[model samples]
Target: MGRQRKIQRMAAYRRRRAARVFRGLKRRLGWALLGIFLIFQILAQLFYPSYLTLPLARYNREPYGLKHRDDMVMMEQSKFVSTRLELTGSYGKEQVDLIKLGGRLDESANFNNLSYYPKKWRWVPFSILFWRPDVLTLPITFDDKPLLNYTLNYSKKHSKKATDASISIRDGNISIKDGKKGLSVDANKLRLAIKNKYIDTSGIVRLDVPEASIEPSASSADLLHVRQQAEDIISKHIVVSVAGRQEEFIPSKEQLASWLRVVEESGKVKLDVDSQVFGDFIDAMDKLVAKPAGQTIVSVVDDREVLRQEGVTGERVNRLDFEQKMSSILFRPGVYKYISIDLEPIMPEVKTSYSFSHTQAGLQAKLREIGRRYDTRISLQQLNGEGWGASYRGTESIPSASTYKLYIALRLFDEIKSGRLNWQSSVLGTTVDGCFHQMIVVSTNQCAEEWIRQFGRTALNSFLYERGISQATTFTAEGAIRTSSDDLLRTIIGINDGSLAGGYERDKLLDMMGRQIWRQGIPSGTQGWTANKVGFLWDYVHDTGIVHHPKGVYAISIMTKGANYGIIAKITRELEAQMYP
Candidate 1:
């Protein structure tokens, strides 16, 4: 028992000793860790910022907020947890970060400075965590006007004023000083180039600055009057013999002005009337006394022209005798001149022929054939000339994908023309022009939906029907916006033929359609240019266009089910061959 007690005591003492050693080891480890931590904090504070930044400048490192165009870009400014130490503050930290920037600008831009640049001193914070946000604005702006304004300002600053051609009159002689063309920053081109160059998602204030010739106020052509030619010595009076009767007449300024003209001939100014002009004067005098002859309307039967009725020939003042006598009187500076006159019989003509050769039978046959062969619904029309166009199930309504945007375009056009809306008039947040272009060229759905909502699809449909722009076409389709090939042709013909939109507005739509990016359909098939709007959804594919063929302009609308653009192109080629042939 004593031995057991002694063994227990020895074990207890050893246990106590082991516990103390372990405690000492743990204490030493804690101190060592504390020292390492202090060193790291010192180093971190030395290089990185100690305080937090404001709302904007946290780029690239542990970004807490959104980093997008117009939106503030967030990032940790490569700051240490404790930058209060003397060793803190990277000399060119922002520049270093910029050099180490991993992001890129827009694809169109090539900003070399973005990739690498000399380091600059970082902003000394007025207060810790109060550094200005490294907020580089996006080159792409939602308003798209800031850069535009900048470009305008830049152009104004750089544009040189043009010197107009100087005119001087001295000693009865006029001379001209050639105008000088001044240098001007082409603001439009500069805007485009800068936009393209800085598109790299790079910061907004990039200085990659990049049209036109500035014509002087007057060019050489404008100074044509500057060349001096001696004025004609006005004669006071002249004598003329009319039918063997002699008479004396005085000259007047009006008569002289009418008879004489100044001309630059062979490097000399000759203030005189030429032979052709004299003859013209005689003809004009004759017209004052002559009566136009009655013309017989002719009829063309079987390619043969026959006079339906006879008409009397009219008499005109015979200019031959008078022209011979008074030919040189005006240019010779004689005042008033009398000449012999006579009458003669003259014949007039009226032209008549049939023009439009509408391919009603042939186009109908071809459209029918195409529809049967393709095993899909089709619609086609020839919208150029006088005859009613041919079609295959063209009146039947079908789903319209992007093609439905045509109605929006047409309606928008009407609104703008009627002063209901203007080019800058807002539709959904964008300008009328902007939405129109986006709806037509880009074939975007959001803008179209917005337009329909704003303009009321029902009202638009009513307008289409009332204006005869479309008979059966509708804006709100049951399953999809419904349209007929004929209806589509009607709008296209309206644009191309001036039956719908007229003047500049018509040209704008046509131009946009011609340049629209989607061209895999009829445009690809036809040799000539095709201004078209295309649509596709699910198994439906369609193209509507006005094609300018060498023979004539014609409109074509092709809609299909379970088909692709290749098929549409094939159909276009077939129709082209048929119609043109």
Candidate 2:
């Protein structure tokens, strides 16, 4: 009896071992099969037979969005994938590809003149199933000029022109225009005929023309829905809450209506904001709603930031996403609630601590490289106190043409602020304020020269040197009228930050700088609000400006010899890419 029990246990152990061996063999086989399949895929990519069909399709990557309904993306996908696509079609016998069809449509590009564009082959097996299912956006371009011309000529000679259904809103009132169907060329049918003839390759080619009744994009029901939507928009009121601020911005209903218009797209009536009006409105609201970013100076030594100052984060409205938010709320019927949007946070251009990613040495290298290419001495410095901006040749003083007029204006304003001079004080037979406008705005030299003579060159140089504007500067044409990018940066920063000029004088200076007529240099480069002073003489051309942005205020001074405004523009653009990137 004991032996029988022992034999049963042995049998069970042997059975378990066999099962383990079988499982090991199965895994090995699976891995081997996978390796073979990968090898085949690689080979197929290099060498595959032409004239083969594969079950594959391309789709848009961004068909899904936050603005879309829950089912809209799926519906869009279904609608997109179900579209019957044909690369080459034939009418009776002659093959019609995109180039052929395009050639037929264009008057200048005759069918005989167009060279056939061959297909770029891709031989991946079952790519749509395993890889790139919902991300491949196939690029397609269609020019309908020839088709429009053909239709115009046909309507003039034989057929009636079809009118599209349209909706319009005037003075908060809605109007709908009904569409009428008319005999039109059947483009799809013609394309199909061309495709059919292309596939056969065994018949006499005869191009055939097809005709069908044209249909309008918007239907009668859709027009009614659009009218209802338009009515809803005019009556709706939106409250924009910015970062939970106390003031909730609410534009008047009339103002909102004036900025809106109704249109049809993709066979459906939709609401679209007038981009021009929106741009103007957003510009006005930028400072009101969007908080500007803050900055901090970091001390860098031995390729690492040792000490850093305090920092603050700022935020601005994401224009595209904000538009989507408005559409999501305003377009839907009975959606009268305020849009809850989380404004995108903007980080300071100067980081809290400088790391290896952006060390002082790296920046100097880039500056030197760009300067070498332009074959001109370049100096760019930040206005942040204590630490200098860009350290490479920042204090190399060159001739200051009209840029020094900024400094002259500053000195004159300083005198007025101290009661030694007044706005009505005379310079070159004009009031000080009036002369300042002419000096800064139009680059006129009379007021600046007269003011310098009145103040005396020694006193002017003493003021600049004492104020820590420049160590050695001459604004008086005594020697060469020299100033550095560092001085310009400090002067602008002082005015804006209330270090140099008092409130009233500061405001006056900044406004004039922004309105400074010659903005072709630094102003043209940076994508922000710029207030710059430009100087141009025989060989010297310089631009120094404070470019204000929601990220952080940037002070730049580009002084060049034998380089035009074009090079200055290019240099500023390159500098922004370095600082902000």
Candidate 3:
């Protein structure tokens, strides 16, 4: 058994050796075949480049067809490809083929004007690398007139090579035998420059016609008539021409056409007719401006529909109507002044609305009676939402006067509520020559200054801004005290309605305002409820306040420019009496 085992081991070893040798021979044969394939590929590219391709598309270094015609031929294939396109042309059996293959031809080519190129051709490249094709452009003309000129910047490629680049356009001419020409462009003055880029060319084509002939024709009389008609049409226009060195005016097309016609007829010319003819036209227009255009209402209202009639057109409004309807609250009829009254708060629950009766004729009779007594013009108004007196001669932009102090007081109260300032905190008072009196007792200007200083001008202005009052248009900066009876009413109502932020209690502010001492202008017999303050100045007696009675708290203010104290007082009283009762 031991001898048999030794012989089997030797046999197995011999078989393993033979198997290793066979495996080695098979691997060597595979490697030799691969090397031979690579060598053949390199030789093919070096000897016949047309058969080669980029590595990405090549399947073992084989040629790949091009994807797009516009794609340039690969440099390796360029030498084997043709690059030019061919064109052929025929005119009445006369034919020509043109080869197109240059940078200049490509730059100026446009397919739209192929009619100009009475030639055509098919491009075919023999060499594999000649894959890119070029285009051909031909010059175009109309009746021997060169209509356009195009340029190709490929001058670098061909120093003196010319690209046929041009355009032609024509409109049938109207022939007039034995007729003088009206205008003609001068060929010598025609300028044309061919730039490489469209941006390099001038956008406007200027035609210079220095001379034109005009002669009477059989229809010349009719033409003259038409020209005269056109001139008349032009003359009717109000030519607003600016006659100065500065370019101040712009003329309309019709105006410019008129001037151009004149320049054509007469040799004198002006580049800008507006600057030349303005003075004459302005002089004529000024005369028409002097008289009012009937009457125009410049005032604007929130609801424009109020000024319009249901069917009939409303007549234009004038200053007189406006003053009577609008400014009546500010002053007496046909005047500018200030009117104010002391309006003390009545009991909130008082019954002031009595039925309209002839008993003393309500508030109207009271106003006439007071007007007779005071000897002053008085006009009462229902500003908030109540009625008292007759609608007066002025509208309601009344001087605010001391009543404006109420606004300051309201602001102070607001500051206290907001924790911005303490009620006990004191500010230095400013003593004006003649304005407000002390803080609460005497209506002194010093007190007004002190309140204004504490609040700060900026804060005051900001407050007014919040209220939508134009900063440029204000009554007083010091203490920012300015009030209109109407506005005061609106403001108080806003406060009551919580429109104004951090508003003061109505009773508290009204009580403080009534404490104001300048109450000499209060109109008697004009009773309703009144909660406001009055102010006085040299030659000015003003009172703006809110009248709160049982009917409703109506705000009323009266102002007069030129009137005796008694006269002004009477007018305000009458206005109030008429409005309230």
Which one wins on TM-score? 1
Model 2, backbone clash pairs (residues 3+ apart or across chains), number:
10
Q: Candidate 3: what lDDT? A: 0.37
Sorting all predicted structures by lDDT, with the top scorer first, yields 2, 1, 3
Top-lDDT structure, candidate number:
2
- lDDT winner between candidates 2 and 3: 2
lDDT of 1 by residue, 268-293 (tens): 53444445655665566545556688
By lDDT, the better pick of 1 and 2 is: 2
- Residue 29 CA displacement from its true place in model 2, Å: 99
Model 1 spans > 4 angstroms off: 1-359, 383-388, 469-471
Worst 10 residues of 2 by lDDT: 104-113
Cα error, residue 245 of model 2, in Å, equals 86
Q: Per-residue error at 44 for model 2, in Å?
A: 92
What would the per-residue lDDT of candidate 2 be over residues 1-581, giving only the tens digit for each residue? 99999999999999999999999999999999988887787566444322121223122333222221112222322232223224221222222233222221111111111111122323454332333223222122233443344334533443445545544555556666576676655555554454444321122234545656667655556666656666677677788776666656676665566556445677556657766666665666677778887886676543456887756888877777767777677666663568654567888667533333344565566676667677655665554432335644567777776788877877887788779998887765457877777677666565677888888888998888888887645765543578877687778777778888778878888898898767778888887789888886434678887887444577777777767788988987877676656
Rate residue 440 of model 2 by lDDT: 77
1 versus 3: better lDDT goes to: 1
TM-score of 3: 0.30
